[model samples]
Target: MNKLKVAVIGCGAISRLRHIPEYAANPNVEIVAFCDPNIERAKQYAETYKGRAYSDYETMLKQEHPDAVSVCTPNSLHARTAIAVAEAGAHVLVEKPIASTEAEALAMIDAARAKGVYLMVAQNQRMMPEHVRAKELVDSGRLGKVLTFRTSFGYSGPENWSVEGNGTWFYSKDKAIMGVTADLGVHKADLIRWLLNDEVSEVASFVGTIHKGGTDLDDNAICILRMKGGAMGSLAASWTYYGEADNSTVLYCENGVMKVGTHPEDQIILEMRDGTVERYRADDIATNAGQQSSGIIDAFIDSILTQTPPPIPGEEGLRSLKVVLAAFESQTSGKIVRMT
Candidate 1:
């Protein structure tokens, strides 16, 4: 394809604010079609971005034959939509928490692999500079064997941030499946795994709907995680952070603690065993309100253009979702859940 044609499935918040804008900004991408259950929303995106609107994704895929597709649907629909996109001979970029269940995620991964198509998960935090630096520090051995870690991601609940204000699809048990844990928690889970270069072995968690009083979904989640590398850590994802968002991670190693976006001023701070400290500043994370170049659009387009493997592939996303799923199991069974 000269300039890769792109189709977006689901014209929701993520689709409108991130995927659409980013793809529209990329010179190498031409958005040809938009599909959403809400036809009016799809029509709006189509009118603004120069695309045809369809209520059904299959029809859009068949009609547009886009070179790439962004699956920005709800938590429950990711696997089916992405798999279909890949089967239709298009590279797919699915939003995070790849699917509601491990089996579904695995199936999606298998389908893309079988079709010999690139299937990437939009785990955008991996593109954040602070996270990039922290992962570098751990890999550099400056931390002297990470002994323990703690990470948190929080914001005012999706009720305020979703496209539907208070009555968003995010709170629907039928769509979101799991609450804050699956929403925000999965992002941190993916980040910690990348930063530590290890997978989770076991998870014991306390998840609840503490602050969002009216919702049946959980507003907060705390997971005690044991990494495969024999290090332990705590992961918390919350929607109860009433103030500004707190997205931070701290790693305590034999040397000292390393903070990533966790400090008051510094974006990256490391204190050594000998008492010396190093600090590094990184760019602010991109959000829907103040959207900027996150490198996701570029990366996805590059992978398709170059026929290279995706940076955050389906398996990588599945690994992160597995931890979140394990936490849910732990919350329900009142026991530590061991990951496969």
Candidate 2:
């Protein structure tokens, strides 16, 4: 396979944890450059990846001419950075929530289409083993027509998780855009849309900054979703969970109820109408289909080589971003926001 040279456009935590390691593991991709406004951070990442470092993304794109680039910057910067890199003649893989607003997301999509380059949003939860299995169970008619879903994602603030503490862009409203909803809620919303193969039709939400000493952004949020299939769902995201990572989803269907969590070994517990219970463990039973850790990077490389569409196309990302924006609008207006 001919390897595709790529540049990483942010030296943040997501880039450090997922993007860099995934790229490093993929043999069909080479990390050619690292870019960030913080020269020190770029230099550090470049040293680790053994690639050129640049504080300016435009200069790096001009010089490297990479096949693709990952936009892992602040939420507010996602759309602009993606457009810049995609217009520079490179495919783009942007991190989640897509953009700070609906207009920006649409602009990014248009830029990618105009440039004739593939643009994928890195909604990596779609690639999770448990998530894929959940989709299969729902699609195979085993769920017997889904009824509703309740999902949540929460953790203590990013102070500990981030290299520079939570004082970074994640807590800043100007930089992060919104807080818990944009940071964590987008993942759950994307999963809901993907697993159910439906778009949200309306939303009523409430967002708050309940915690002190944090940035001026929502620390917690709750939203009610009215899906296209006439299913009603609720989702919550918080940075004040106080203990352990809480990433879980529960789906209630006509035939049974299914629960998925990041813990307990990525298992799916099913409780049927007959009072019989079954647990599906991808780790133990199924050879871990889609278990590849670097699936996104590999898929990006293949898209470049084959001229195929990306796994999570830019348009899909905009749809998810619309959910986020609608929720925010609902929170401010105290009304149901139509998501047509």
Candidate 3:
């Protein structure tokens, strides 16, 4: 079997911890190229992963002609990089929030379609063990219909985790656009949409830069979402938790409440109205302090090899991104924004 030639764009923290390592672990993948604005950083990863390094992605694409590319660039660069990779006739696995805007995301999708290449969004939360089990329980009708819910993702800040430390692009509006809302909020938004198998029809949100001093982008966000299935939920994303990160979700179903990532021993918990309780232990959710395989690389490679749709296709990413974009509109206008 000819191993798939894979390249990574942006040798950032995510690429270092997740994309590169995962791609290296896949027996069917051969790391062929790496690109980053910081040539030194790209060179370091290239040395470790046995790939050629380039400061410009276009040069790497032209020379390497990889079978697939992972776009790990900042939020603002996702659309353009992914579109270019697709136009180069390579599959794309772009980091989450897909693109800065809906128009950019649609353009990327169109590019991939025109090239007949796979375009996947790296929404890793959907692949988390606990969330996957939660989806199964919900689909089995074991939890009944989810009526109300709350999901939160919070940590100290990107300064602590990003490779650039306090001076990361996450703090820049031109580079990151929205702070925690896009960095963390999009994960919960995408997770909830997948878990409930529903579309967010309306959004109302409040976002502000409370802790981060240097940026105008928000560091905290609280969004209220109404699903097309009539499920209501609140999503909280913060960069001021002060302590350990909190990634938890609760679903209030007709029969009981389902809790995920709330307990150390039990990753998922179910409490019934009639006094029944169940506990489940699954793989721990990945955090900055302790990283784990996201299963995204394998899925992306599998989708391409099998000639099937990616697990999180570009359209699904667009829907999830629309929710985040609506939340931003709601915050700015001080009015509920209905999803169109």
What CA root-mean-square deviation does each model show from the true structure?
Answer: 1.4, 3.1, 0.7
lDDT per residue, candidate 2, 249-278, as tens digits? 899999999988734764788889989987
C-alpha TM-scores of all predictions: 0.96, 0.94, 0.99
- A best-first ranking of the candidates according to their TM-score comes to 3, 1, 2
Residue-level lDDT of model 1, residues 107-191, one tens digit each, is 9989998989999998889998777877888889867888998999988888778888888988888888989998999999998
Better of 2 and 3 by TM-score: 3
Candidate ranking under lDDT, highest first, comes to 3, 1, 2
lDDT agreement of model 1 with the native:
0.88
By the lDDT metric, which is better: model 1 or model 2?
Answer: 1
lDDT agreement with native, every candidate: 0.88, 0.84, 0.94
Among the numbered candidates, top lDDT falls to: 3
Residue 113 in candidate 2, Cα distance off native in Å: 0.9
lDDT of 2: 0.84
- Tell me which residue pairs clash in candidate 3: none
Report residue 318 deviation for candidate 2 (angstroms): 0.9
TM-score for predicted model 2 compared with the true structure: 0.94
